[model samples]
Target: MKSLTSLQHLSDQAILSILEQADGTEFPDFANRMAANVFLEPSTRTRCSFEMAEMNLGMRSLSIDEAGSSLQKGETLYDTVKTLEAIGVSAVIIRSKEKAFYNELQDVHIPIINAGDGSGDHPTQSLLDLLTIKQEFGSFRSLQIVISGDIRHSRIASANASVLKRLGAEVWFSGPQEWMPDGITPISADEGCRQADVWMSLRTQLERHDAMEPVFPNYLEQFGLTPERAERFKPHTILMHPGPVNRGVELHTSLVEAPFSRIFKQMANGVKVRQAVLAEVLKTKEEKRYEKAV
Candidate 1:
C-alpha cells in the first residue's frame, strides 16, 4: 500500500493517473472496506471532501477529532493510527498540527493520506489546484502563476509552488515581505497582477500568528486582488484561492465570484481529486493482496 504524504513523492505518471481517474465516470467498489479521518487540527474543506469521496466510493468511514479522541488522554498519534488499523480500517486520513506527522507512522500497515500537516505540505490541495489549472489552460508548461499572501504560514504555497515549478510553470511569490519564505523573492502585487496567467491568493492565517495585529495595515490596497488590480490582469488570467478566503483582505469581496474566479471550482475538484487518490491507494493494496494469493 502507498501513502500519499507529500507531492514531492508523487511522480508525474501517478499524477496523470489520478487526474485521469478523476475525469472518468465509473467508481470503483470498496464497499466492505472502512476508512478513518483523524483530524487533530480544525478543517472544513479537506475533511468534508475526503468524507464525501469515501462515501461516493462506497467505503464506510469514521471521523475522529482531538476532543473526542484518545489523544486528549495523552495517547500519541502513532498509537491512534495503529488502533484504527487494529480495528480493521482500510486506510487513514490525517490532518495534524505537527509537520511531517507521517514520519512517525512508517510502520503502519494501512495507507495514510496527509490532509494537511502544520505549514509543511498539503498534497491533496495541490492536486485539486492542478486539476483546476489543467482544466483551464490544458497544461502547466510555461504558465505564469503567482501565489500571493501568507506564504510562510500557508501549506498551500509550499505544496503548489514546488509541484508547479517541477511541471515547468514559472511560479512567483507575492505578499508582504515578512510573510515570504527564504530563497523566494516576492514581486510587488501590481507586478504579479500584470504578469500572472493564473493569480492565486492565500488567506492570512490569523490562527497561526502570534500577534493579533494585521501583517499589513493596507493589505487589500497594497497586495490584494482589488477591482482596480483585477483590471490590470490579462484578459485570460484566472483567479484562484485555497479557501476559506478573507473576503476583503486577500481579495476584494467582488472578486470572489467574478467571472474569472476558480475558487469554487477548486472546491468541487477537491472531491474528484480525493476520489482518484483513494481509489489508487486502495486498488494498489487489493492488487498486492491478489498477487500474494496467487
Candidate 2:
C-alpha cells in the first residue's frame, strides 16, 4: 500500500507482517532515503516515535512546524506535500485536525502515512498497540479487551476496534453513555475491568465536548481508575492509555506506574511498529521502481 490512512487499509496478512517485524531484535537500514513529518496539530508520542523510526532506519528527516511552515503563509495541504516531494522526500507522515486530511493528497506521488487525522484514525498507534498486546498474550484469538473513556472522540479507539476485531480479538467499550459509540456493546467500567485481559483507558477529550465541565462531578468515583478498581482487575490484566493522560480523569495517577500498566511499553513499541511500516511502504515503492526500470 502507498499510504496507511486507516486500519481498514491493512489486510490481516499485512498486520501480521508488521507485528512480526516489530518483534524482531535486529534493526534494518533503508540506505539514505528521506522522510518528512508534517504535524499541523500538537503531539508528543506520535511525532517523536515517527522521527525516531526514521532515524533508526538510517534516514534523514524533516519535521514541519505548523507555525513556521508555508501553511502559515497560506500554503494548501497539497502544496505542502508537493514541496516535500520536490525536496526528495519519498514519504511523509502527517497529523492534522482535519479528518482524512491525506485524502486530498491522492495524486501527490509520495507515500503518505497518517500519523493522525482529526478524530479519524491513528493507524500506527493501533499497530503498536497490537504489538504490545501480542507480546503480552502471544495471540489475539478471543482475548477480551475493554477500552474505557471518551470513545466518542477517540481516533485510537476507532482504529484499534477495527484492527483488533479483525485479528480475532473480542473488543468492548466502556465509558460515559454519551461518549460511547453506536453498535458496540457498552458495559460498566467496573464490570469491564473485572473481565478484561487488557483494560485500555482513554483520556477524556474535554476539549471536544460542549459541556467542558467534567463529565461528572466526581468522575474519579464514577469512572476513573481508582485504587479499589485497580485492585479488582484480573490477575494478568494489562492497563494502557494513548497518553497526555489527565491524571485524575480517566485513570488514577498511581495506575500510571502500576505493574500492569503498559503505557511506556506501548510508547517503546511504537518506534518498532513505525519502523516496520516505513520499511514496508518504502521498500515496496523502490521494488516497483526497479521493476519499471527493467
Q: What is the TM-score of each candidate against the true structure?
A: 0.97, 0.96
Number of backbone collisions per candidate, in order?
Answer: 0, 0
Global lDDT of each candidate: 0.91, 0.87
Q: Candidate 2 lDDT (Cα, whole model)?
A: 0.87
Model 2 residue 241 lDDT score: 90
Stretches of candidate 2 exceeding 4 Å from the true structure: 25-27, 183-185, 211-214
Question: Weakest 10 consecutive residues, lDDT, candidate 1?
Answer: 207-216
- Leading candidate by lDDT: 1
RMSDs, each prediction? 1.3, 1.5
lDDT of 2 by residue, 109-191 (tens): 87899998888999999999999999999999999999988898889888898889988999889877777777666798788
The residue pairs that clash in candidate 2, if any, are none
Give candidate 1's whole-model lDDT: 0.91
The worst-scoring run of ten residues by lDDT in candidate 2 lies at 206-215
